[model samples]
Target chain A: MNRKISIRMSGLGGQGVVTAAHILGVATTLEGLVSTVNPFFGAEKRLAPAESYVRISSSQIDERGEVLYPNIIMIFHPHVITLGKCYTMPFFDGLQPEGILIINSEQPLDLSKEDLTKLGQLNARLFYLPATQIATQVAETELSTNIAMLGGLVGVTRLVSVEAIRESLAERFGGRKFLASATTAALDDVLKSKFAQVTQLVDRNMEVVHKASEAVQEYFIKKKEAGSLCMLR
Target chain B: MIEQKIVEPEYLFFQADREEVFITGSEALKEAIKRANVDMAISYPITPQSESMHLVGDLYVEGYVREYFRGENEFAVMSAVAGASMGGVRVFTATGGPGTLRAFEIFPAWAGARVPVVCAFMTRGVNSPLSIQPDTIEMAFMLHTGIVMFHAETAQDLYDMLLKAFVIAEKPDVHIPVGVFADGFFVTHTREKVKIDPAEIKLPPYNPYSSPVPVMDMENVPVRHMRDPFVMKSNFISYAAHASWQQEILAAAERARKHIHKYLGGLVETENEEAEILIIASGTAVSQSREAIALACQEGLNAGLVKIKSIRPFPEEEIRKLTQKAKAVIVPEFNRVGWLCKEIKSVVEDNTKVVGGPRVFGGMTMPPHLILAEIRRCSQ
Candidate 1:
């Protein structure tokens, strides 16, 4: 009955996953929602795997701690898929049937049939966006990929307004005007792009989200109908 | 002098009914912060002291406290509090033995600049064996480093001393970094009932010193008044700076002694006026010594105790007068034999035979009975 959403963002160091987590938290808080952002990072220099979390809810959060089983998982790097022993994978276990998973990568990934079978055991929905490619197309580099992935997240979850995300980005990167402008532009492109060829990648990512949400909704409707039938019988 | 309130003399007894609650020294610390009206606290998690940081984080989420900063490390935590204090906010921080050692470099910078940063230090024995138990080795070694240090004897003391530490540290004359030290195993992990009274505590406003802000001019431009060559040659300016430092130290010490005497009243005292044997101790050692003395008295041994409330500037005069009547003095400290007891022996001088009992084995609680035995042996 709670309208709470837990999101985990992870990537190799320097990809700005930590910053993206904070931006998401601040944006969600700005939209009259309660949010918490926590990061788990070591003293590793650039290129090491870094992970952060964000939790947003309509009401005050009782748990002021870690995200054990997150509702959404954002993988910002493509290669981490191969690093199968990453600590965040356990959070995907026993997820709610309607939970959403978003991954940000440069190319569409083909999970081995074996991996797909493992994922099918959990009833949650999964969506992956080639955020690096979209960022490179709009910003001329992958420097703004975190922001691009954030745009896709806002578009999908609608947990926080895109304008709130923009405001948070501007506030956090106020000193770095060039970076802020590039990120804003990238986010705007994701929001404005049509369902066409050059933007076909973004459209495909959206299609995955759309289909997953529909499947989740259908599963829940069947569950409720089954419950009513049982009560009548 | 403010007129002292006349209240009924009652024994300070711990309410046993509340002991069943699972609480740690870290929880006591957070309760102290809430009572002291601390506006913000920032810390990074580390062993033995992480619970204090977690407690503050919990309170902030509960809306009982405001603005808790989760920093990257001990360095960030200390610097962030320094910055927050400069911005006129009452800020606090907590760290354990290793974390405190890591933060050691920032102490003089904060003290010399006179930032009233309040921190709770859980004194764990350092190096080699690497035990995280309560010991005063760190506190004894670092006491003279321009920060005011208060040792908490009990869980209640941790709560009370911390509340007092912020008030005393933020005073105009004593605007130096202050720490409330508790033994890591004995106090850091120990749980007891701590009285929390928000209404009785009054947090003073932040008042920065009148000196101009320090800035490094890499361009070699003349910033403020430059040192005059003539004055430097005459040694007048050099002498004046040295004298100024001496006077500042004396003034700060006098102010703390006077404030403790005036505010704390009977709680700060020298006992058994005619007794020829004086034992000086601080923090939990005082409680241990008191228990020892009580047992010694039962066994018909005559010895007195002097519990030091403030360790910085060493309270030399008060200690000297207290030990003047004694033919022999014993100092029991929870540190290596060479530090605080040696300092006390040096102060009390040759006339009084001084006996030093340092906790050679780290983290061992010297029982009162053992202390009584030590007193009997020393007297014989």
Candidate 2:
């Protein structure tokens, strides 16, 4: 039986949260798994609160739009939570028990004791990575944070392979027409303008992806050695 | 004499085996039109519809499509589409929400003209408050149009129905326009596995000579192609002709059922034959209903689902047959108007057995739990 796994990624408008979700959807398909990504944004100009939902399954998926009761929640911007910029009052309101929450932060979340207790009660797993920092450092652009976040997604869940993500990245960013529609052409135009300075944009993003993935891998190993303890900030 | 030349769609997107691709509903619909070998696509960009048309616009360079452009507005695009179809080619366009209403007045004329032009309506909320979100309110308004309607549940259905829309709409006897619908982003923006017809097998060409009206190609075309023969005469003749023409459009849609059955499989799909409590729904609501049914079954309740794939011609017989033995029929919808329930109430007759609510408007999701609650209530 093919079961669907729901994911929600939240961030500001400029963080490519939508693009990250799309990349993950494509990566799932590359692994012969079916997936859908529907982005919901309220950006009037840019940097406004944005969210995208992605669902992946081995069988046919019936659900659409936002992924409520998500098993995986990736927040691209810390402001969505700290500044209360999410669509809902409680950003993590309906997370399933034993859910995974990945925060794109430079350091682990310095959560309140109440928040820590809640995660403990739910048996949730928390991971944080310096997604923006990694993107800026490795890919040399703030735009590549989505790529870094996608790498973190793969590393955390292992839902899609790193190789598949690499393939999807090339298909999307490597000057190749994946589906060859006008929308795709427009996306390419945007990318060519954005990534003009990067000599090999896809390659630079791949480096960021690997670095993020390795950090996630190391976090898991450290957690295992620390007596199943979820390290809080 | 009206030529009895029935159009058996020779150019089905696929005649041989299908080749699967992972894509969005927008792309799936576009691919179906591409495989159908559309001659001209006159589109006005609108939410839930622009992506499909924008992508179809790219097909012009691929040689799969001869002409594609963005018209000024829905009304202008619709008129251009009417002209293009009359000019003897397979024509296509799409609109949703306010766009659907903007082009609303042109549809009845298209029906009277008996053009087999196929349009896709990815449903959304109309204006005033101004929302670009998913809603089926506009579809309720369209229920009275003579156009043949097929509401799809998934990306795959969107692809299949669009190809079949051209086939069924062009049935010589059933030449009213076909509008295939799916909810906005729920279907349009969501990517899924949609198997397309093999590229090697192309759809047959659209033959304009078979049209019920004159082909406006400057050859053997009717001189007054815009005016109906009876409507061009006396006032009494015009009223009588218009009244009878409306009936003819309905009759043509009625005649299309068999073809819709043949090409797209069936109008309605029923699940759980022996269940006593039935849930009737359409589009993505059917998908939600399926989950609700499974959950109800897990709770040891006897529940089934009747998914109405064809909304126009309303699938009355199928709904009646499917719900005959059920103690209660739950009609859940994504709109506040309860149009699906209204259609069912008009048919099922037993007032107590029909449940209309758990409706979600303004793009709020009708989660499975909502339907599960309704199913539990109905089971009692």
Candidate 3:
């Protein structure tokens, strides 16, 4: 089996969506898996709707650009849903069957009945975490919110090993400068200043990942006999 | 520059050891230039192409490049690149879309002068309303510019084509500018695993003395001549001289076939050519076609693929032959004009068999599903 996994990360700009995709891609590559990462094409403006896509496979990956049929979708901010700050309308459009969706929120946002019914039909798995809260409480920086979101993804799907994530984090922050964009490089400077050294930055971000992984909670959406909406923990 | 052993082009391209690294197309270009032993690189900032030259500038800081600087604009930069190349040194530069049009006049001039300049065109849309997105419509204009053009399908192609372009363009029998174009953003911004050679070995330095045209180094030839510029004269001699020179440029590109084959394998690469349905494309569209072909195969539609690597010396005979037995031919493109489709249609015998598109322009990605839809429709 090819076992290819496609992930789409949607978030507001300055949320490290591109950086998170880069780290995940490197981790998958380190595990001897093939992966390709691409940021959404748009002007690099803060707070704008931003997205990044990653495709990981045990075999070679030929497809490129945005992941139109993503098996995994990561939402990094509540605004992506509540404020429609997403390129993909409904935020979960084109998600694969039995797909995993990890949203960065302490509680489930009020999803529409139509959207919920569609997700239920697809048998989608929904996971939520207070990712920004974990970043601030554990990593001591909101900039680490993207790392926290990755932790939630690992908690939900274990797509990559924690050790690989650690090494990838080191490679991104401790190794050479990785430029996702000019704004990203500037944000990295602000992040690096929060820690005493590169090692400290990696260690603190790892803590954010671990806490977010454990903090993540699944909200089960089941289609009742009457087609009524009910969420079960 | 860091000390690197000068190795034969064949040895470096084929026998040299390589390692796989996940990097963006821009980074891959930097890696290629590090081992190209280039003498100088001029840069002017433009979206998609800016990062590539920015990374190349980093090479200069790291001592991998001998000389690097920013130019006033695309035209000035291209002119500087030509001047540097005419001075008997390997030179590199990059521009795209608007920048490509901005520096348009210099491209043909480079070929007419036979400077052996290697330029990377990170192709994008050039419309009235500005767009910094991937589109190859600019390539249609460049086709008649008398320069050899190669379209890269991925970052790996960008790297390999760039390195090999230098050798191809500098051939004594076919000295001319070679444009290595990659779809902006699709290849430039996308990150994927690329195999690259070690940094300790580099291609041998260019020997300008072997150039078909006079090197402007002033070493053995007079520094200034042209007392009566040819363009100033409108007699038959001047007209004939210009006409023959243009023909020579065209001949130079034709002469490059054997060299391109020796390095790039062929102008076009075919897969399952015996199949009745064919998808012919270049650049990132070829990448999309691979996915669509795989999908089509799952549906039991046996479709073949023809990847056109060299656009200038187009695989005319190859395309015509490949499409001869096919019932349907599909050409997916990222540009609005469907220039590639027009080219294939012109060469293929059964013109109606060629489908102009399923094209997505203005930076929209061609969902493999769209191409798959075409395959399914073509089968019906």
Best by lDDT: 3
Candidate closer to the true structure by DockQ (higher is better), 1 or 2 = 2
Give the CAPRI class of candidate 2.
acceptable
Report the C-alpha lDDT of model 3 over B150-182, residue by residue, as the tens digit. Answer: 999999999999999999999999999999999
Who wins the DockQ comparison?
A: 3
Instruction: At residue B89, give the lDDT of candidate 3.
Output: 96
Which pairs clash in the backbone of model 3? none
Over A1-233, each residue of candidate 3 has an lDDT whose tens digit, in order, gives: 37789999999999999999999999999998999999987776899999999999989888887788999999999899889998887567889999988899887888877888888899998888999999999888899999999999888886799999999999998887445578888898899998999999998888888898888888788678323434555
Runs off by more than 4 Å, candidate 3: A225-231, B223-229
What is the C-alpha local distance difference test score of each model?
0.61, 0.79, 0.91
lDDT of 1 by residue, B1-380 (tens): 11222211111112112222223467677766655556788988765677677777766775545688788878778888878776666788888677777777777666665667889887766756666555677775576667777777666678767867776777776667788887664555443334554323334434444212332323333455676643346487778875686567546645676655544442335666457777787776776677567667778888888877667746777777777768777777777744667767767757347777735445555655556667888778
The DockQ of each candidate is: 0.01, 0.44, 0.76
lDDT of 2: 0.79
lDDT of 2 by residue, B132-251 (tens): 888888989888878888999998899889888887887788888999999988888777778887654455678788877778787883567464576467689788977887898899
- Tell me which residue pairs clash in candidate 1: B134-B184, B134-B185
- Once fitted onto the true fold, the runs of candidate 2 whose alpha carbons sit more than 4 angstroms away are A41-45, A110-117, A175-200, A217-233, B1-15, B221-238
Interface RMSD for candidates 1 onward, in order:
16.9, 2.9, 1.0
